[model samples]
Target: MYCYFDGQFMPISEVSISPMDHGFLYGVGFFETFRTYEGYIIDKELHEERMNRALKDVRISLDYSFDEVERWCRRLNEEEGGRDGYFRWNVYAGEEGIGMAADRYDHPHHLLLRKPLQRTERGTSKRGFILEHRRNTPESSMRHKSFNFLNNVKARQEVTSLATEEGILLNADGFVTEGVTSNIFWVKDCVVYTPSRETGLLEGTLRHRLLQLARQHYEVEVGCYEPSDLLNADEVWVTNAVQELVPLHEIDHVSFLGKEGPVYSDLHEQYTEYVKERVSEQC
Candidate 1:
């Protein structure tokens, strides 16, 4: 697929970054993965906020504006007949010598990647498992969707079924953190529960929106949680920008209502309408 790197658009195969880049040498980089509907990026402002927060936290600079970014994104979509696509924006500190610079990176490399969307039934359920690898603490004060993803990758390696299962990670304190690539939510006694940022999980864009929307119709709770608290729940679901929201039918032999859960059904419906409304406004 065609992608944008540096200042030019090229085939993804032709794009490359320097090995000496701090992002490679020191893991000084961040990214955002999202999807487009009708060629519109959903909740991009939220995504950008997350990106900007990471940039600020690590002293990485952005030389481009959102308008330019959106234009490039639209151009990439147009190249492929404008079908809905998965998009990833990668920003990294530019090449610096071997030693720790102890200086803010003024030049940053930016790359945009596009891939065809892989469709999954909206209400489909995925099994969940507790991973053996504990989630590492945030590199900075708070977690950003940064290139420091090896910890997540290592934990995901333990999943028995990648296609049908999601592996949840815990922190050193053994509190439920999140799924490999998604934020987790469970329902008990009509209340929705999810791990807070204090647990060191990258708060996904959709997860942020769900917290606000869920509050309008249901009592929502966010705090540190243990496996037993989640296991005792009646329903469970995971959220990410690409997948939106997915129900987990079982975790550790504990069965949930999955798509049939009343809370899941109502929230999914609400979330769907919310997307449609946002898409219409963009149109």
Candidate 2:
């Protein structure tokens, strides 16, 4: 695989970062991950909007624009025979010594990583289980998809140790927060439910777009919810850019509609068409 570091493209194995880099020293970095479709990046604006807000929160400045990102994507994909690929756009505060600097970061470092796209087919299902670790509060006002991922990493370890595909995390107040790496959603009595950002979740781009699509046909609710509310849902699913939307067969052996649920089927179809439409536009 090839990764663009700073200003050059090279093999991922050859790329390196200084130990004193603030991103590695004090976790002062943020990133976004998405997949390209026929060389076109979907939801680029949403991803950048989120990344910019996170960078601003920590006074870390990034100068990369969408045009630059697209060019990088095109080049990186061409490296793999022009195939669509998964990409990680990471920017961090350049070397700033050991201590936390009070001034804003002017010399930022960046890396554009490319990997094979991996996602399950629509209608496939995965199971979820609640994790013993409570969800950690955001370091700032909102959760930034940053390098500070120890909490999620540990939860992910537990999920693997427990042999579950999706691990659900709860706030200290016992409200359903979100999946370790994805936003959570459920359907009940034809109304769609998901935890609000107040629960300290990294509101995903797909979650936001799904809400818009669902609102056109079903009532939508966003708030702090309990596991019981989820276990009792008519349908359950999790969303991320990589996975798009995945049906939950069951959580804790309590089965819902899973992939066969009417809501999941309808919304999944809509989402599939949405992506195809974007690909068509690119063509």
Candidate 3:
């Protein structure tokens, strides 16, 4: 496999970082995972903008432009047989450091990794497990895609079933936030609801796009919600860059009406069409 490390393209085996790197030492790094359809990246500009904002927030000094990053992604995708796959862009403090300080670093390291995407049925449904882990406080939340993923990792470990799709996490105050890997959403009485950004959930790219697409068809509400809200929902779904949207058959013991509910079917169909249009424009 080939990856982009720093400014060069090389075999993945050749890429390495210092043991003292602050990202590894203090979790001072952020990453973005995106999907490419036949080498066409979806929402590249939005992903770039989000990453830039994350870098600035953490004081990571990386000067690469989005155009340059996209070019590298295209090249790597072409080299990897031009199939649908996942791309992860990781930026971290490169300087050797031991403390929580960011002022010591002058430049950051950039790593781009790629892997072929596993095919899944578009109508696939998932069963969720309500995890005991609570998301970080709003003030301490790394809402961006950061390397500090121990919370998510721990939550995922609680899911013992292979058939289970994801673990739903709540905030410290017992309000539903998101899944370990995706943003959570539900439809109740024809209204779409998701946890607000104040819940300390990462405002995912696909989540944002879906909200925009949904608002044209239904009333979209974002606020603090409890598990009972999802348990009684007519339809439940999760969204991310790769999964796009997955319907939920049940959450813990609560069974939904069906996997492909009416609203979900409509939104999923529209999202699929939207993806096709975006990919065609890139082509």
Better of 1 and 3 by TM-score: 1
List lDDT for all candidates, in order: 0.90, 0.88, 0.84
Residues 57-141 of candidate 3 have per-residue lDDT tens digits of 7677788876677778889878867666788999988766666773646678999998988788786888887889898864344
Candidate 1: residue pairs that collide: none
Error of 2 at 58 (Å): 1.3
Q: Model 1, which residues run further than 4 Å from truth?
A: none
Could you tell me every candidate's TM-score relative to the true structure? 0.97, 0.96, 0.94
Candidate 2 residue 182 Cα shift, in angstroms, is 0.5
Candidate 2 residue pairs in backbone clash: none
TM-score (C-alpha, index-matched) for candidate 3? 0.94
Ranking by lDDT: 1, 2, 3
Best by TM-score: 1
Per-residue lDDT for 1-283 in model 1, tens only?
8999998999989988899999999888989998887877778889888899889887887867665677788889899997778989999899887976686899899999999989988888999988899999988888888888999889878987656899999999999999998999999999999999999999899998999889998999999999999999999999999998899999999999999999989988998999899989877
What is candidate 2's lDDT per residue for 1-283, written digit by digit as tens? Answer: 7889989999989988889999999889989988887888777778889999988898887777876897899899999999889989999788989899988998889999988986556777888998899898999988899999898998898776322389999999999999988999999999999999999889898988899888888899999898899999989999988778888899999998888999988998888888889778768
Sort all candidates by TM-score, best to worst. 1, 2, 3
